[model samples]
Target: MEALLKEAPKVNHHLDHMPNMLVCENLQKVYPTPTGDYVVLDDLQLEIKQSEFVSIIGHSGCGKSTLLTMIAGLNEISGGTIYVDGEPVREAGPDRAVVFQSPSLLPWLTALQNVLIGVKQVFPSASKAEKLEICKYYLDKVGLGNDFHKKATELSQGMQQRVGIARAFALKPKILLLDEPFGMLDSLTRGELQDVLLEIWQKEKITAVAITHDVDESIFLADRVIMMTSGPYAKIGDELVIPFARPRNRKEVLEHPEYYDYRAYLLNFLNH
Candidate 1:
């Protein structure tokens, strides 16, 4: 862990020079309702550099997940553009992969098969052996090596999400979009998964955006925590640059003075 923590500075320094992996400019989204058009997000601008971990937090209806869906191209934009690696994102593709709040796994498929479904979709040209290898590698990386043959119904909620994480990583995407992926778990399980995710992000250096309401989770996982105002036309309210060094220990993070300050500031922002 010490060595990993020491390496973070170098990784961050390298990220400073890399191009933006994801960019949203004047973004907007709206839905046509029975009476009128509902504006969910408007004039929202965000830029995420390569290898950065950023989390967005807000009230339930504040469009946090809506923004993520736009970036993933799962939702349409009423205005502006979203670019991934210099290309405009108009549809869902392998470049951006999303892990939703629910595990959303196929109950009948074994964990290994579930991940392979994505691997095959993204890398259809790979041989069967290669696909299997890719699936197993990520499953093992997420501490699920022994559960590969287990069906989704047989796994715990946490274990199922590990499969979801493995499936997303197996795609080797340019941007990872997570929408409250850990929100359903107990505190202990959520913390465990957070550590697993951090370890993978550190090694892979994939640009990541997560939507989470947990203040501690935001502080621990993100390079920057972006807070949003309440909807119906929500934009970025403020962004806090997390200063804690990585491989951040939960106990150490809680002990740091700025952690509490950050927590209090976020809580106040949300409650205001």
Candidate 2:
């Protein structure tokens, strides 16, 4: 067990020379109400390496999603700064793609068309043939090859979310931000998508940060789990390195003893 635990830190050692793919320093978020300013997050610092999958988990009001939005450059930061691939992020760009909790698909467009819209926007310089190939590839990658002609209104909720995933990956962003993208799926569907996502993360090695409420999901998906304290002025309280090797199987992960230990620790942290 101790040997298994040593593997994650070893991975970090080789990445010391690589510049961080994402960095958040002394991050702060505040919202103004009629009465006074409400502090949601303060003095938070986080760094994610190239291709690392990290999950942030905390209580409902801990500003987890808010932090993701700031990194995406969709929301203004009250203080501190965010850097992606060594460049400071000031606005949304093609370099980053985000998938939110609700599958925000254009209801009128077919799955292929929906993905093409994003691909064309992000890769406008590419030839039309190239863009069409990209759209087809990601939609197939998400197991939606047969449903390419279906619109959002004709698809199940799970299938709609798959379209969302395909659209995000079609952009070929260097970083992917997920704000509880699987929160609404059933357990079986969630597990299927988790494996699909992990396969893509392994193949592409894109830096990913996800905000999740499920402890088991974090253990299954992340290289490290960052836990936040209860709000107001919530910050990273603790973190656990998930030492399980990649190409991870759900059954194998469940059989591992340390998985339960990590689960217990996270449950305790959130409960207290």
Candidate 3:
């Protein structure tokens, strides 16, 4: 643990050179149901620096998905602004890619085709061969090299998720937004994918904000964990800095003394 703290300065120095990635200030969201206006979030603020990994955890119906959608510009903010690299986010763009809990793939398309569509959208100037290469590269990165030709319906849930993950990363977005991407998977598969995501994030230096319910998952992958209160009007409850070392191993991290303590703290916060 002491050695990890000593290495922190080196990590910070590396991060300093990268661009300011995401800033959400006083963000609010409200939905008008037939009965009344539903206030999902209120006055939320968060900043994710380049290459930073942030995890948001909250009780069900706490607006975690709403917050992620706002960041991705898939949904409008009722108030406040989400800025990516100093520009206000107005609509969805290739710069911010999202992976949802469901794979959300086109059932008719092969996994390779699904990824190729994103590559082409982001890099329209690239030749056919270039797009194909990019698709293959990302598919292989997600450990799906042999399954590229499989249709979405043919693949298992975990494999479908691999395709979604591949498609999101293939675009090489400036920031990655994930809304419970692995929440539905079994424990063992979830752990495997978490490691895969960490490796990709490390290698690409991509900024990431993930919404999850699992405390251990957040601790394993995030530099910081932001917990939200339960809603009618959800807002950030606490921000916990994870002092774990970079290039963390899931098994070794679980063995750390502070690991259970942090887990207990988050669990207590959520319950309260």
Query: Which candidate number would show the highest lDDT if scored against the true structure?
Result: 1
Pairs in steric clash, model 3: none
- Candidate 3 is scored at a TM of 0.92
Report the lDDT tens digits of candidate 1 across residue range 1-272.
23333433323453578788889999999999999999999899998898889999999999999999989999888999999999999899878888989999999999999999999999989999999999999999999968899999999999999999999999999999899999999999999999999888878989999999988899899888899999999999977777688777778988986566778777878898
lDDT of 2 by residue, 1-272 (tens): 34544533534554567678999988999999999999999999999999788999998988999999999989999999888988888998767899889998999999999999999898889999999899899889899869999888899888988888888888889899999999999999999999888887788878899999999999999888999998999999988778788888999999997777778878878988
Instruction: Work out candidate 3's RMSD over C-alphas.
Output: 3.3
TM-scores for all predictions? 0.93, 0.94, 0.92
Give residue 196's error in model 2 in angstroms.
1.1
What lDDT is reached at residue 271 by model 3?
80
Ranking by lDDT: 1, 2, 3
* Ranked candidates, highest TM-score first: 2, 1, 3
Off by over 4 Å in 2: 1-11
**What does candidate 3's lDDT look like per residue over 1-272, in tens digits?**
34433433323344566677999899999999999999999998887788888899999899999999988989988999999989999999989999989999999999999999889899999999999999998889889868899988999988899899989999899889999999989998999899888887778878899999999998899988989999978998877778788788987899987787778778878888
lDDT for each candidate structure: 0.89, 0.88, 0.87
Candidate 3 least-lDDT 10 residues:
3-12
